[model samples]
Target chain A: MTLLECKNISKKYGEKEILKNINLSLPSDKIIGLLGKNGAGKSTLIKLINDLLTPTEGEITVKGKPIGVESKRSIAYLPERTYLDKRMTVQAVLTYFSDFYDNFDRQKAEKLLAALDLDPKERLLKMSKGMQEKVQLVLVMSRKADMYILDEPLGGVDPATRDYILNTILSNFAQGASVLISTHLISDVERILDEVIFIDKGQVVLQESADELRTREGGSVDEIFRRMFRC
Target chain B: MDFVFDNNIPIYIQLVEQLKTYIVSGALAAGERLPSVRELAMMTKVNPNTVQKALGELENLGLIYTERTNGKFVSCDSEKIYALRLEYAKNISAEYLAGMKKLGFSAEQAVIYLEDLGGEDFDTSGM
Candidate 1:
């Protein structure tokens, strides 16, 4: 069964159409990279899937149902912006998540927090931007959701922290769960991707397995993207 | 043992070669059980499916084996491992010689450089 499917999906804000006739079906048990440049409507597409925004046209299904409460429940999303309350302590935020999501694993989050040396008593506002990102990742990953959607996960962090983020994601990966990672930093996360969907100018220019893309293009995904979408 | 990857190459293939090197170098001792696929994935920061693919290749090469109920194990067949080690050694040695040759050294001079670098037993017969 496909984890998520978006058919003829398009979104508009007043006069600006962000995505156009987008068709994508994500299968279980793969790490798929959603590659695109800034302002390429990647965030808009993600928001549409999470039901944070309604698409102007077309439909999206999660586990074969239209985007609704069940679809929302099935997807664990980390949006580009931080959504945690600034005043809440790390432990308090974990409690907030646990109170909301039935699948949230408090114990697992605690373990990950300890591993990353993040203080549970510290307020989210007190932590550095990098640490905040890690904390957010820990919370999101602790949930055993069917599909994990991470947006710009590698942005604005040191390389070492970025690596930890990747390891945390992989470590929490459940069997048969698909991960849709939307990032512009192709080189950093490209190795872990099983499939890649390249979105250019609000449309999917290419969707292929990562290895096949590499083999066919005779270059890394980053290199191919550079040449394909050169300025 | 650090496993480095080349972005230009298929990651699973690199994993296979690196894991084989671990077996060949005794870093992964003979008959030792390997880590679970998820554990390996976290350690290497690759996807679980790709790591499994690499393990599958290692199993096909007889460098690793599955014990069914138990996890994968490095092969207990010491001779096969010895043969693999020799093959890797020869390939690496040839690469080193080629590098030295590219710097305008004759085969004999390259062997002398290898000797100085403690690369003993570089047979000069081919020269």
Candidate 2:
């Protein structure tokens, strides 16, 4: 079944259009990469799916229903920016998540945090930016949601840590769940992506199987993106 | 086993090739039980679906098999393993000959150079 669908979606700000005629249907049990350069409206599309921003036209649906509280219940989102309170410790944030989301698995989150070498009792403010991001990822991924929407989960990190994060994503991914990852760092995430959606200037340029694109274009998704969107 | 993947190629295809290499080279011995898809995926740091796909391909190729609910295992057929090893050696030989040809050496000259460089005793160092 299609886990999420965006039909004729568009976003605008007064005279300017941010996204136009965007149509995408994400299937279950796959990792979909939303690839584009800066200001390509990747975040805008994500926000729309998460119901943070209302589309100017058309509709967005999760499991054939319009975005709402029910839809939010089944979608776990990790925003591009860190949203945790600096004063709160990782443990406190985990408790907050546990209380807020029925599907939040506190034990799983703790295990993931420990794997990253993050101290649960340590305050967010005391941790580095990358560590905070890892905590955020752990919290989001611990949920047993139908879909996971992560925006730039690999934005700031060392190469070694990036591999750890990718491994965590792969290891904890449950069956029948779909993940939609949006990022400008294509090469790092390309290997795990089942499908790739290229969005530029607020419109989807291409959406196809990642391997099929690699096989047909005779290069990695990163190379194909570079070739198609070169300056 | 660790695998360094080239992102240019399909990941499942790479998995299939790498697993084949391990089986033919005895790194993964015949009849050796393969890791579960999830375990393989975590070990390989690739998606589970990709691992499953590669395993499915290997099963179709008769390089691996499933024993009901037990688990997947490398083919125990000696003839099959031998034939696969021969095919791999042949391909490597063809590629080596082609490289030598580009450097202005005939197949006969390549064989002579190979004998002089390393006779019957194969040097496994720096491999």
Candidate 1, CAPRI quality class derived from DockQ: medium
Highest-scoring model, lDDT: 2
Runs in model 1 deviating more than 4 A are B103-106, B118-127
TM-scores of chain B, in order: 0.87, 0.89
DockQ for all models = 0.68, 0.74
Model 1 Cα lDDT, one tens digit per residue, A1-231: 688999999988889889999999999999999999998889999999999999999999999889888877778999899877899999899889999899898998998899878778999999999999999998888888999999999899999989989988888966689999999999999999999999988999998988788888888999999999998
User: Which digits, one per residue and each the tens of the lDDT, describe model 2 over residues B13-81?
Assistant: 999999999999999999999999989988888888889999999999999999999999999997998
Q: Pick by TM-score: which candidate is best?
A: 2
Tens digit per residue, CA lDDT, model 2, A84-114: 7889988899889999999999898888888
RMSD (CA, angstroms), candidate 1:
3.0
| Deviation (Å) of A29 in candidate 1 | 1.1
The C-alpha RMSD in Å for every predicted model, in order, reads 3.0, 3.7
Error of 1 at A90 (Å): 1.9
